[model samples]
Target: MARHSFQSAMATQAGNGHVLGYTVWNHFFRPETDELHPMGITQLNRLVRRSWREPLQLYVETAHDLRFDPGAPADYAKDRDELDARRMQAISTYLSVVANRNDVNLFVHDPPRAGMSSDEAWRGDKDMVHGAPRGYLTAEAIAKGAISSEAPGGFPITLQPDLGGAGMAFPQPPNFGGDIPVGDFGGDFGGEFDVPPGF
Candidate 1:
């Protein structure tokens, strides 16, 4: 079955003089088997409603490729650009809804550092497009003693532990070292380090 009625909706909206544009790059169309589930519109809605947080992580990790034909006319290129912008705006809106509902922070990934341009940074990793929330879902967080839901407010009411340290730390290097000795150190050089005498 088709994933979403996005194209038809876009057509109707455009007919009504809306600024929205339509294109296949939006990934809202139906997919064949072996394709990613929940194409575009459904994916956004599912991310908002998912009880598990890992799927959200996966969604951010998945790449969204936007390509254009090299020989397309200038007018077609302009339309495609506009459509792409609208699609991205829609995705951002969905993310905002999910973050607000869950009472979690949402932010764009950090800007590129030295030796990396902004475009390269974005294209390098799909996860780099958005920052992940620090803690798991409210229930998971509460069970882990990371937070409390009994505060005066709703859903994500209280913080039993600070959010800053909730996320997993980056991987550390394994502890290991070579036992080989260097020349002039402790062990003999096996006479392989013979050097000519200097005047």
Candidate 2:
């Protein structure tokens, strides 16, 4: 679905036992729409049929640029960090829905411990991507995820072959940028699923 579609899902699910909204760093491999990433809520809502409430989850990317506010024409909620705790509070909302303990994933790529190489990465250390400032899904927050993993320091990233998990599974945590293949540039990517009864 698109931005409108996503918001419709959230607003409908809001206060209904599902999640209200999610905190974010405003970055990701957003499927290009008009040569740009579509709306987050819209994207999430579109995948409602494949959603799993038992572990109904969403990813929150963070980086330094997450400190800024989003522009107008908001499809759903606003991406603004007018205050400090509110930022964290936004994330807290996601936790509330899942009823989990701060299940936040910090997708960052700093020098010492960065998960991104393209300075213009959506969640890079401090770069502008698609007219939006880089976000902060801090490494410190990964542990908060339902299942957090990391590629230790200095492990060159490599997009060996995760072909949507056809038959290959990563042995270790995923580093930001290895000499791998696929993805925006070239890194380990893709998450697959089993085919249903019939395609």
Candidate 3:
């Protein structure tokens, strides 16, 4: 069924005590259109029929980037890896919380296995190589004082780059020509300094 209409029906059910609330799965997208329309009666009826047995549930898509581009930089690769790691950790933490509370059911499709094309990978055929949605859940936990650290499995968690100044640094490549004169490198790198013997 078209997602909007399904959502509307779910809302109606919630209002009438047919259900408490519903969860939405998959990416949210709206086609470019001036007016929104509801799903067909057949689809709505099918959904309502299933609602009798199906609990309110939502699906969380794997938040991983699957496409590979050969031209990406080394820095980008490193940053992407770090970001994915953090994301997965967050998801783990969130799952842990949900399990503890037993209040809501969260559904996630298994990621595809390794070595698959992006299109095939989207079918849950292979695991993701990058871009997992883990960190946000951990971040929310931390903000709510639910978790002391962002680490999953009870391991020590280091500061993530987004957390503050962690992993931040000024690029200081080796001065192959030796240190340039302070006058030559003015502004931020400027100031009075003793000249080297050679200079």
Candidate 4:
């Protein structure tokens, strides 16, 4: 699924001639499901190397923690912490190889903390993982500015111009022609799962 999504984004970049960036969430790798354990990282490395060969910029947000609910079990929290550490380590290793720290830039979300209650965190009304919308907004804005060269203070930026492009162009995803299915909603939706305009 990650590969497909990454390829799709690359294809979109190809068509639009815009830069590509990604935010890799820490929880995306489920220890129970072994999501992106080693193989996924390998594939991602290949994709990054391929994309790095392009003249465009590539931004990546490394694994970041957003506190999880333990539901009163201390052991569960401990296990989750351990699993998160391993995933972070794997990503760190991958970045060491693929990330040049310049054109292939790297950034991270704010460190996880008890900034909100478990209930609030679960609701994610403010942000995706924590109820801190301000921080998310600030981070997003800074990243956008840095990518567009319209703002400064995106630290750790070191200029290197000698780097050149190489590697194969990423392939586009296979098209399965059809409108996406939007499950049943009580309200009147347009035909074939299409949302009504101004919805």
Model number with the top TM-score: 4
RMSD of 4: 24.4
| Alpha-carbon lDDT of model 1 | 0.37
Candidate 4 CA-lDDT value: 0.41
Tell me the number of clashing residue pairs for each predicted model: 0, 24, 11, 0
User: Across residues 1-199, which tens digit of lDDT does each residue of candidate 3 receive?
Assistant: 6999999998886663422222121122112111112332232234334554544243333334434457876655565455444443443344346433223344544333324678865856323321222332345454666534323332223323344322211112212234774333433422233322222
Model 3 weakest 10-residue run by lDDT: 27-36
Model 3, position 46, has a per-residue lDDT of: 41
Candidate 1 deviant stretches above 4 angstroms: 1-39, 48-72, 98-199
Instruction: Give the per-residue lDDT digits (tens) of candidate 1, residues 105-128.
Output: 322221212256777777776343
- Candidate 4 ranges with C-alpha deviation above 4 Å: 1-21, 25-30, 33-35, 50-72, 97-199
Off by over 4 Å in 2: 1-25, 28-38, 66-88, 91-199
Give candidate 2's TM-score. 0.21
Candidate 1 at residue 8, lDDT? Answer: 81
TM-score of 1: 0.23
Clashing pairs in 4: none
Query: How much is 18 displaced in model 4, in angstroms?
Result: 12
Model 3 segments beyond 4 Å from truth? 1-72, 101-199
Per-residue lDDT of 36-83 in model 2, one digit per residue for the tens?
134543544343334434444543433333333345434212332222
